[model samples]
Target chain A: MAKVPVQFTLNGSEKAEFIDSGTTLLHALRDKIGDTSPKGGCHQGTCGACSVIVDGELRLSCLTLAETCNGATITTTSGLAEGGVLHPLQRAFLDTFATQCGFCTPGMIMAAKVLLDHTPNPSREDVVEALSGNICRCTGYEPIIQAVLTAARGNSQNAA
Target chain B: MAIRRGRGVAAINYPTGMNLGGDPTQALVHSTPTGNFMVTLSSVDLGQGMKQIMAQICAETIGVPTDCVVVDTADTDTGPHCMGTFASRGTHRAGNAVIQAAKEARQVMLEVAAEELEVNASDLETDGQGNILVKGAPQKSISIFDVALSAHFKRGRSISGRGMFLIPRSYPEKETGAMKPSTCYAHACTVAEVEVDDETGEVTVLTVKNVFEIGRALNPKMVEQQLVGGSWMGISHALYETTEPYYPNRDHGGTDFNQYLMPGPGDLAETEIIVLERPSADGPYGAKGPGEMCANPQIPAVANAVFDAVGVRVDTLPITPERILRALKAQAN
Candidate 1:
């Protein structure tokens, strides 16, 4: 194993870290940056638990080699809420009870965010299509779909 | 291009809690100087909202608001004994224990409030909103917080209570092997509508409608989430997952989920759930548990639907397209 220096912006902060060559971005974020919000569900990229926004694109952090993302920006679930105010998707997820176990939540939320960014007000079918990559064992897909649909309707989040 | 649709229904019942004596869970409730109460348990949440459910029980029992009760679980060293969180026992078993503990603690609270107000302990009643008021005089009241301070400092009595709930064992009858298994049983029924392609043998689930009689839904939102998650799991088990003859024939089989099929978001169907409340006589707040029963009915419902659609009975798990085609061919022959 060889350690390599990689530089990138994590949650809007500049960071440079040394990691082994075979390290996945999920490990880099969790092991190096100490951000455990991005989960390591299935390292083969099938389970979207390790979802991260890389340069404004939702990518599975487990499949992406840390060294390959040397100069890119990364956003994990930790960065979704700004200044203690949760994003609409995050709020909707809580309100709709979209999260259960929360292991796959960050990825699911990231996946839904990309869809809303592309289509501000997507139909139910569109929400389903965007969530194809993410898998949630709890709350089924209906709650997540409803949460995303609610967020798309310009409804403000009310966290309880 | 010939797609045929059919509907099928299934009903199932499951017992709550483990069926053995000494399957006990202990709860410890102690009041804080800030007038809030903390409950400690050894049962794990496993993301099932056990902590929240326990908090709700404690709040109601102690006559405090739901927010004033905090639950801390899964510290094996510090927390008391718990039989774990499975068997849908978090609500029925552990919840019963919490109710007992909070009730004991509330007795002391009323006593202290009585002494401070110069009234009989029986005359003081909790408003269930963090206040102790005299019966028939709602306007005359003192906050539970101030009374907690008096109990801790002036009266010098510890405001803490411990509780444990255990089920008794019943001897089975010699002839029938029948005995009490659980304190209560939860029932569910599901109807699944699916479409099958006559040519390709591909099956598409369209909708799932369900009704559950879970005694009483302790937390209605959490109950709904459980049902929704369970329905998909049933779909995955019935139609997508498989581990079969390929293992001995091939050295390496589908090792991960990519090779082992599971349903994704694209495969999700419309879901409608109806919850019926039938209060349990013994359960805390007339509530029973609804954990594993969530996924039981979905499996057979889909299988029955496929049979209804193609007039072929494929009695196998993961009712794959290959199996459906094979069954269709056999029926044609």
Candidate 2:
């Protein structure tokens, strides 16, 4: 096996690392960059726990190859906040009590961020469709759906 | 393609705390000189918010704000003896232990404050802001920080308290095989509504309405999570999930999430919950366990709902489309 050189911008910082060609981007982020926020659940790319933003698109890190991530701008749940101020999704999740066990929080938040980035104000069905890939065993989807809607409302209020 | 809707109800009970034989949990509480209180518990949080509930209980008992109490649920090497966090025993078992320990520490704190203020400990009351004041004279007060410092340096007192709670074993009845297995029992009643397709034998759970006598919620949000999560688990077990699809062959169940067939966001049903506060006599702050009880009742409720929807009883796990179709065919024939 040959070691491949990969360079990517993570959480707004440029990082370079050499890894085996077989390593998934999930392994590179968690093992190499030391950002454990993106949880590894269901490595089959079904459960969205390992979700991340690659070049402004949601991609499952568990499925994305490390070699394929070179020169890509990556964002994770760890980068959602700036200087300890929680992101809108994080605040909404807390306020609506959307997260329980918190194992799926990072991925759920990432998915919500992507939805809000595109839709801005999504309907309940839209939120459901957007988060259909993510699995949260604890909240039963009610609170998470409500949290995303609330975050969208907040975004609209802030814009007003 | 007609969809028939029907509803059914079931009620169930769950015991709080493990009381097989002297199931004991201990707590260690000590007041730091900086007016902060530290409570050591061996119970794991497990994302159930046990740490938050215990911290709130400790603060309430000590007459201080919740933020002033630090619940250090350290591992077994550092923390006190807890039988781990399971069986819905964290709030009922560890909570009582924390209450006892906090009260003892509060007594010593009041005593030190009494001596410093030249007043009897009985005459002083905690303002819940770390201040001990004379009952009538608001101006006469002493901070807990001063008392804690005095207790540590001058009075030769450590301001620490220890507490342990155990449920003595109740022998099983010889004939009935019945015994008191826990300190308290929590109850829940659930009604599940379902829509059944007679042609395809598909059952979709529409809504779940529930009433829970949970003693005290402790934290209402946490309790609601258990209820909602348990409802989903119950629905999954009834319609969507199974391990022994081929019985008597314990080779392997469904391997991954796709094969396991758990309920996703699209399947989430509407829920209406009514929480009844019937405090338990023995539980701390009259709080009982509602963690596992939520999942138990919905199993029977969904089964009954399926029967009501199609007038056939399929007494199997993950009531599949095939089973429903077979039952309907048998009934029609």
Candidate 3:
């Protein structure tokens, strides 16, 4: 297979990589750009472990073509932190013990970030719906929901 | 199309560690030059918080803060021997090994502190706050950091220890096929409530309440994680999951997550867990294994709940809508 060139902004940094013609964004990001935070739980896009934000919309990177994402601004779990400060979702995950095996944490956090960005004061049901796409075998989904709720409450308090 | 509600309960006693040719695990503990402890083992964590719990056990045994201890595992070349991480043996077997290793390393740490304080090793006591103080006088004390510095630069002694734990093998009688399978046992009981739709033959688990008697909760949060997640797995196995829809025919097995059904977060039922600690005599810090047992009783409990709901028995796993419908049809006939 012939290799193709693709360029995109990843986690605020401009990264250009050469990939196979049919390479997925997940493969491009992990293998080509070396940003391995996006885990590939299922290449079939069933498990949301490869979730990433492309142009402000959540897309399963494993199912997305890298060439289609040209000039797109991508956000991942690695981009959530700034200047050595953890994102509210990240901090809440640690504080609430939302992670265990942690393979699903990146995608779960990314999904929660999208939810909080749109609905800053989400309810417990909202958190559950947002994270339902991601599969976490270790946490039983309760702690992750609690962490999302905690993050939303923290964000609301900060605004107040 | 009416929904019938019913409840069922189950109790189980799960073995902690298998007695297969003397289940054994080894650990190596050594103090760094800065007085921090490193525990080395080949045991894998498997997301069960093995590393974190091992660090806690090592810190407690060495009388040091947990933050000062680091657990490095699963490097067979550098790490010590382990009998794998299955059969719920990581906490019971590897934990005891880590405790033994930490004790020996703690002995050397105290000896070094004793030399600096000009007191006998027997008279020295660790304050659990990085200080080694005399038994009678707390004023005369040496920091573990200073003790490590002296042991490394001045005393020229290496503070290290190796430990291994082995369970005695119990052989089965040839005719009777009976033996002591494990050293310690963890018990649990689960009460599962479900609503069954007679028309659709769909079972919706309403709630799962359970009590576990795990010898001790080394880390309550980790134990809770296992129990909660394990119960979810049990629910999945009871209703949604099946690799072979038609067993003995390898034609249509699920190849991925899409085909293999699992209960999503939205499908989760209300779960309540109560942990009971009955400390074991031989366990490390009286901790037994709660890894695999947390998923056991819920399988039967769910199966029984389905039987109670519609008064029809579905003997096979993953009490699917089809199975329930078939059983109801057979009952009607």
TM-score for each candidate, following the candidate numbering: 0.93, 0.96, 0.97
Clashing pairs in 2: none
Better of 1 and 2 by DockQ: 2
The runs of at least 3 residues in candidate 1 whose Cα sits more than 4 Å from the true structure, single-residue gaps closed, are A155-160, B242-254, B329-333
TM-score of chain B of each: 0.92, 0.94, 0.97
Q: What is the C-alpha lDDT profile of model 2 across B1-86, one tens digit per residue? A: 57989899999888987776677789989999878999999988888788899889999998989999998986788788998888
Using Cα atoms, each model's DockQ against the true complex is 0.74, 0.76, 0.74
> What is the alpha-carbon lDDT for the whole of candidate 2?
0.88
Candidate 2 regions off by >4 Å?
B175-178
Ranking by TM-score: 3, 2, 1
lDDT of 3 at B244: 93
TM-score of 3: 0.97
Q: Per-residue lDDT for B267-307 in model 1, tens only? A: 88888889999998888898888888888898899999999
Alpha-carbon error at A141 in model 1, in Å? 0.8
Candidate with best DockQ: 2
Task: Give fnat for candidates 1, 2 and onward, in order.
Answer: 0.74, 0.65, 0.61
Q: Between prediction 2 and prediction 3, which has the larger TM-score?
A: 3
After superposing candidate 3, which stretches have Cα over 4 Å from the reference? B174-176
- Pairs that collide, model 1: none
- Global lDDT for candidate 3? 0.91
Highest-scoring model, lDDT? 3
